[model samples]
Target: MCDTCGCQLHEHHHHDPKVVEVNQSLLAANVQQAMSNRQHIEKMGAVAINLISSPGSGKTTLLERTIEAMRDTVRIGVIEGDIETERDAERIRAKGVPAVQLTTGGACHLDAPLVHGGLHVLEHFAKGAGYDLIFIENVGNLVCPATFDLGEHIRVVLLSVPEGSDKPAKYPATFKGADLVLLTKVDLLPYFDFSMEEVRKEAGLLKPDLELMALSATSGEGFDAWLSFLDRRLNR
Candidate 1:
């Protein structure tokens, strides 16, 4: 039901004027909602981090380790986004932190409006105590999630060692938008053919001043810097 082409295909190769207008409108609304979300997060006395990565990139594992390491010091809350399953939220809950699972049903990304609801739920879980850090674990897709902001103060994009070093070059939009690029699963570096130098160069090309860190959540390798980074963000 395209208003321009009169064709049923809404996502055709040609740039339909109506489709472009609709997309722009949608993004505009999302941007407004995202700004509101940021204000809400600040009001809750929390700094939000949006974690974006492909599936199996160890985002949840990183959160698990992070929560275990700093839960006593930091008031942590999580909003888990996925196409289905509350498993991630349950895992965070086991670590004894408040987590809200937002199932998109089939959507590949979590938008600000959805996260706004999650923030309220997370606040209710706090019982007016509020949080020091809020983690929005975005749906595991490198592409769509990059285009939407969930009201996060910082956006972290994780690229596991096994995913290969060419990912930064392959997905420039995702890497370019990252505030921090985490090279996770460095413990498996020896097993994979991943090149650290290549990742550094490619990601540097995408974002010259991008902060990159390598860490193994399983082996606790290069984790101190990651924790320190969070500490600075929370303190600032």
Candidate 2:
């Protein structure tokens, strides 16, 4: 079978088995760490929310508004994930809450082990006051973050109005994995061609019973419902 400096060989040796095994082992380790992280969160007397979305979806802006609306009543903490800068964590810290920034270097996603470290840092900031809620803002990506669990009590996915309503259908894996979906930046809905009807229809097709909420961080529109949702979760 010598055609272009190719020698006769069997197909069984074409694939490397070690690579598959390594990947499986890595995932297994991540799952184990995630379970442990959940226990760690409960021990801190807090319920964690893992937030996933694309860049420019106003995740930080939403958090800023939320902290302002709730800081007086709810004990809050934040863990901001990003590829490089500590800018988001700084923003949250300015709001008078404990925030930890975990830079991924060049990775697209934040794994459970990385979050485990962030949780420890947050605990130090708690100073035994005990937190009511912990928000883990995952790096802005619709895909890779869905595959990893940060030991969060709930997973929230955000889709901004300008991003188009077709996102759910295009990125089914992310939408399908969400415990709750937030359609943000509704203030610009009139300017953009994004249809709320299409978003609901397509997202429903993927997750029939998925809880959905629409809000604009800038305008404070629909934000009361969002705060109420968080209140209910904390009460539970």
- Candidate 1 residue 128 C-alpha distance from true site, Å: 0.3
- Local distance difference test, each candidate: 0.95, 0.93
**Which model scores highest in lDDT?**
1
Query: 56, model 2: CA deviation in Å?
Result: 0.7
Candidate 1, 151-184: lDDT as tens digits: 9999999999989999999999999999999999
Instruction: State TM-scores per candidate.
Output: 0.89, 0.89
Looking at model 1, report the run of 10 residues with the lowest lDDT sum: 13-22
How does model 2 fare in lDDT?
0.93
Predicted candidate 2 versus true structure: per-residue lDDT over 1-236, tens digit per residue: 55544658633334334533344655788999999999999988888999999998988999999999999999999999999999999999999999999999989999999999999999999888878899999999999999998899999999999999999999999999999999999999989999899989998999999999999998899999999999988834
Where's the lowest-lDDT run of ten residues in candidate 2? 11-20
